[model samples]
Target: MSVNGDSEQQDWPRPSSSWIDKVLFLGTGTSGQVPAIHCVTKPDFGDCAACKDATLNPTGKNRRGCTAAAVVGRSAGDKQESTILIDCGKTFYSNAVVHFPRNGIRELRAVLLTHAHADAILGLDDLRAWTMGGVIQRHVPIYLTQECMTVVEGMFPYLVDRSKSTGGGDVPTLQWNIIDKDKPFTIPASQGRKEVHIQPLPVLHGYFGRSSPFWCLGFRIDSFSYISDCHEIPADTLQLIRGSQAIVMDALKMDRHLSHFSFAQALSFFASFSPPPALGLLTDFTHRIEHYATQEQVDTWRDGMLAAQLAGKAKLSRSVGEGGGTKWWSDIWDERDNEHQMTIRLREKYDPIDDHNISQTASHYIPPIKLSWDGLVVPFDPRRSPSMP
Candidate 1:
């Protein structure tokens, strides 16, 4: 479905009281997560740097859970803030135990599931903590596509149809709402003046063939968009999120995979925007991605793109390594893949339009492209803090 784009910065009205105060990155890794069992438990220890770092430092940027987030805000005239969980994945319980109390997230107002993958919906049973024993006064509402709801019903029959529950100490009371991928819907209102509006972005995740592709959803809320998993975004879906102020996209690893975007692919998409998003963060990473090294790699690419725009160059010739190499990028460059070619084409098409915003200090037009870690918190408004390391 098409949602209006805020092409011009002035067109976005500043909210006196932000509808969304902040977004907390509950988890930022793929289903397997960081510090994989084999990586740390091997006799000689595995060679994965990200997993090793996560093992040594229990609470570090290298440590990550599943890809999930919480949208936190207090609607107008509400006494308490409402938290809408984006995805309750495999590590939802562990992630919530640590972060929920630390961030003052007491109650879950609603849940929005992107899809019914194990990493996205396996934690449905854990919501019993809030629903049982009258911990939460009312039944929790969950919104998902009809296909996803069907999967949930199969996986957690007790959760969907309470009559099927047997010998249950306590089961979560829930209300299911089936959503349409082509429609934009609103979260059920609480004691508030406004309800959060969400736009569903259906994109390809994986496929059996050209005609039958697995559908995964990305969501658009105000100026923020989150697509935790995607292989390709259709042209129409791309237009829906064109002028987003802040975005969290999937960049699984340095190499192109069948179902997810690679580092360069995500970078190319981010840079294709007119002025680029104010804040562009990458998530859903794999073990191959070491936290600090990936950050440096992204910084180098973002800098090169900004430099090309500033110089009015049609191609990027900023090679940083010796023998015409470019450090980390050179190591992962796949001549067989078309990612490099796509990057060049995007520079030729969108670089000229960003000329007016590019300057000697090019941080304004060039969004900070960060490899988001677990527990990283960012303001929902891009104008408040546009750049965060």
Candidate 2:
């Protein structure tokens, strides 16, 4: 659990010329998505409040698309800011139709894939809109691992080899580039734009068989990292992203999931970093999680950690296990004791008082670790420490 090192030494190598400025979350839901058709159409079914809200309000927080985002920034020598997309999941078209115009994103500099899952790569054909029957944009450069590219090749033979396309339908034009998990590569610069440095972080999505792990690629663009689908992060990856300024991670639900990080697991990993990341965003949610409700839980957890840091000691627990076995758990601010690991739970209520109303100052506030919603635009400055936007 211990990934702490000298904070100064853990800083990612800064981009020589270009850097990412912000990330736009296009989708935050799991593969099935929210307001699932089955749940809404079930006879006399009213069990899920989140899905109900999503159905009633199309653009509400409860409504979500498959997890994906765009890294937006201005590379040196570019006439305008460029947007590099992270994933093109099943809901890519749905998300793009909304967020692209909403954010004024006109150019797609590149597309980076995490894995070859249906939710992650099924939207490959949707790029036709961008290509526009050979009218607007030209061929887009796509980067992915050999395994992911192999899946794309089989699923989209026409895209890889346009000769296979039949019926004279206009297909998306693409130039494929194979990426390696161990190598740090550069996003090929568009006209007048400089190349952007990227470090690939291969994580365990699940397992292929009994032992071999299903690898997914996560990317680190300077101090920001995005891992939208992962069950476990290896020691090397952990060390590589130890002092990230901001991270958009996968937390599928409150309970443990076989292929995604549960709320507890994601928080534990965040706590492992010294002083934690400046901003920690949890995404890839299921209908089981209500947006505001989950944010409240994260707020409570943050308050508890802040309290422990202020007290300078682990607080005593009220409950005792069988045979008078008392349980103690707390999260320290700077770093946890490497010899022991603590399991922290969210409190029903962290503080009754309204801290915002009582005082405008946030001297004791811990960095936010909260859930992300669809169409959420998180702006950050790579030249400085991240702050709320």
Candidate 3:
């Protein structure tokens, strides 16, 4: 399936001056999230031993569900801003509120759907809260592939058949845009801001009912690529994701699964990949894989990757992103590495970005980076890519 955007292009043009500064991971857990109910219902006699500790550590990663993120853009002096939501799955509304400020939903410009699965599209209706308010409300735009539209219409007949009776209560106010595979599409940063292009790469998801294969998508926006929920990555899709500076793909567990990539399989795919992404991450983890264990695994991998780059065994691509930063190139031996180390600097004289004032609705970036107990947000840019910190 294809849309109004280019299906095949050598490259999606990067904004010469600036672009979105960061992509924040909203929730990184698999469909059931961590603390799976079955863990208790069916105890270790046959229950989840790995997730056993998730009960004691309520705020731990194993307690998570639904994976998504916010792609944020801002202007100098905070004159303009844009927030694009990737997917609003079943847990989206709950997770978004925790990650973003009160106005998070109200400020979204678009919603991109990777597929029609319940975990990926369930929270869609909750968007009505954003559309029903304000003196002048506007319909939110939703982007999806033709294959997705078919399943979506079947699932939410009310959303497709506008003619249906509503009995006066508000429903999702949306406008749908069909994206063409291998095609790149553009969305304005804001009303007068520059445009950001999103590249849609088609991937083959495993069969739905044992006899019929289905399709899903992964997207490349600017310097990063996000691939979720695919059992297989086709040759064409790999070609499309080749040049991303950072990539976050699905690796649902440590062991092989019918519908998702195990951690080893995921790492192997990119380890041998050409023009490998500078920083590679695995997401969409299920409770079966303990959060602490996965975090330790990722940390170990990062250490090894940095060691390889330092020893000249691997090449780390350089890139940079926005706000309170610069654009430059350097080698590992360069002393400038110290200068590029992320340091928080307040733009204001006295209004500090303390925990007290760190609102999700902040007009500009809070600082270079922010860490949390549940997840982490690492800033990225195309101009500078440093070793993992």
Candidate 4:
């Protein structure tokens, strides 16, 4: 799908009063998830970060799970605000249990999809539990491209086949809303006088130059854009999200992937979009986020990142929402992966958008990227955010 972002920002939805800013990082590990059942810490890879993290944090945020998150209405009063949930992945059930309890949800308005990847859509079955016995039950809307919708339907025939009975327990009640990548759509606002309009920014999900590009979506909702799984962000799509202050994207692993972003690929994508400053999802972890050798791209990036942070890289870490407190991100890491704001600033200093810089960045990356664990929530402002020059 081709989307022209000439002046699409006008279509963005205004913020509402009923919603809160908190984005709970539900799951951040990839498909196999961290602490893979078949993980070996020595032979092939080195010390297991997943196992180490699990040991240190235990039930805390250092623990990783499937990818997903919940955005709740931030309120302390009597009125229970509206609830809007993003992707419901494989670990969404467990991750939700860990992160969703903080913001109590009264009404679930819609479900947005990045793509119908299992790591992104598996927990859809669990959505039934949310509607099981509510006083005013509602069929949550599932928004996605027709291709994705068909896949979802194929996976769960009973969801659409009315004649099919729910063997015993409750099945997820849903309202399938087919989405067009070229057209922007609006969902009921949770806390504002107006609705929240989400613009789809279509980008190629794999390869720099593939025989047939696997084009997928990365959404632009105000100042924040989310691309859960993708390998390449075309020039046009980059321009659309360039203005976002906080952009969350897929950082499957430090390794190269087939259909997902590798360490360098994700960094390059982030570099193009970062407006002087910007920072950054999830999927599998077992075979994906393998032990990083000292020479791995992620290790290099991490080392460079630490150095930049120590040297006072632009203060990129900002509180995402009102109630999230400082520990929110780590708790989630205690939960997913993405880029850093430093890469943007550092790349600008490295050189202008020249072939040399792009070449340097692209040279290390081997295409056909795989992905990692999921579960993360971040904050962003659609209206008031900086833009790339």
Q: lDDT per prediction? A: 0.72, 0.72, 0.59, 0.52
**Reference-based TM-score, model 1:** 0.81
On the 0 to 100 scale, the lDDT of residue 20 in model 2 is 64
Candidate 2 has which clashing residue pairs, if any? none
Candidate 2 Cα misplacement greater than 4 A, ranges? 1-18, 43-45, 208-210, 315-366, 382-389
Q: lDDT: which candidate is best?
A: 1
Q: Quick one: how many clashes does candidate 3 have?
A: 14
Give stretches of model 1 more than 4 Å off: 1-18, 208-211, 315-365, 381-389
Q: How many clashes in each candidate?
A: 0, 0, 14, 44
For residues 136-172, what per-residue lDDT tens digits would candidate 1 score against the true structure?
6567789899989989999999898888898954788
* Candidate 2 lDDT score at position 196: 76
- Candidate 4 has a TM-score of 0.65
TM-score, predicted candidate 3 vs. hidden true structure: 0.71
Per-model root-mean-square deviation over C-alphas: 8.6, 8.8, 13.8, 12.6
Task: Give per-model TM-scores.
Answer: 0.81, 0.82, 0.71, 0.65
- Ranking by TM-score, best first? 2, 1, 3, 4
